[model samples]
Target: MKPKKILLMGVSGSGKSLIGSLIAQRLAVPFYDGDDYHPEKNVKKMRQGIPLSDADRQGWLRTLNRLFVNNDEVVIACSALKNEYRETLRQNNEDMIIVFLRGDFDTIWSRHKQRTDHYFNGEDMLKSQFETLVEPTLDEAIFIDITHNAEDVVNAVMRALQN
Candidate 1:
């Protein structure tokens, strides 16, 4: 199969990075972390448990778009919580395929609570992420329920792509 650009998108603690890395490795493509593209100010605000406004995210999304522009085949892990953010990315690269990782709030919250050294805390930001999530409609993009193991999730996506 030819490698294609993919966006692994979901809220924090939903395992976007973990799954994206595995998928990228399987596809022999480079993987980028969208968090690394965030401006220092945005990082600081999130570190302080503050939700960022759209203005704060605009530059970050553009940075992600640049990565796609430069790479032929890549997988990116991002908390693309809103439709506008996804649309901006698509505008930059129409071939970009969004892989929406859908997980229940409790599952993500427990995962977040177990993590250490991350900027986002589940208690402070989970609600905001859930609120921001505009679950992709059938005609919008590929959506996957992430209630299974990581490998299983990846396999499911791979199988879906094959069809």
Candidate 2:
């Protein structure tokens, strides 16, 4: 069966929000951007170029996970940057579909550089994000290249969902 609960996960600049929003809109479901859910303290630390510790992310992860508690159709853009984070999200929702938007440093850096106004800065934090990410294997999630245009990436994710 096509998966319902969805998490579009990737590094900071890997198009999670853009693609997740598009997919959710097409699917006629509510879309949640995980960044908006970060606690103010976490944002403050990130703004000061401090990489958040696992402890710092715990509550936020729980908040996102709670979104899937009993919902049948939902899409969320999150950085599920660690194996544990994904596991936390998948706790009660075993069939949750994870879509990873994969891209290299230079590619992601370029996209981040183009952003005029965003809470998270570039490079330093980008490296931290990559350092934290434990990418899902073939059976764990659907992986798509973020090098493609927005529409194409969304199309790919949609097709993967239908599989």
Best by lDDT: 2
TM-score of each model, paired residue for residue: 0.95, 0.97
What's the lDDT for residue 88 in model 1? 81
Instruction: Please give, for residues 34-152, the per-residue lDDT of candidate 2 as tens digits.
Output: 99999999999988888999999999999999988757889989999888999999998898989999999999999999997688985899999998889998899999999999999
Clashing residue pairs found in predicted model 1:
none
Residue runs of model 1 more than 4 Å from their true location after superposition: none
Candidate 2: clashing residue pairs, number: 0
Report every candidate's CA lDDT: 0.87, 0.91
RMSDs, each prediction? 1.1, 1.0
| Candidate achieving the largest TM-score | 2
Candidate 1 structure, TM-score to reference: 0.95
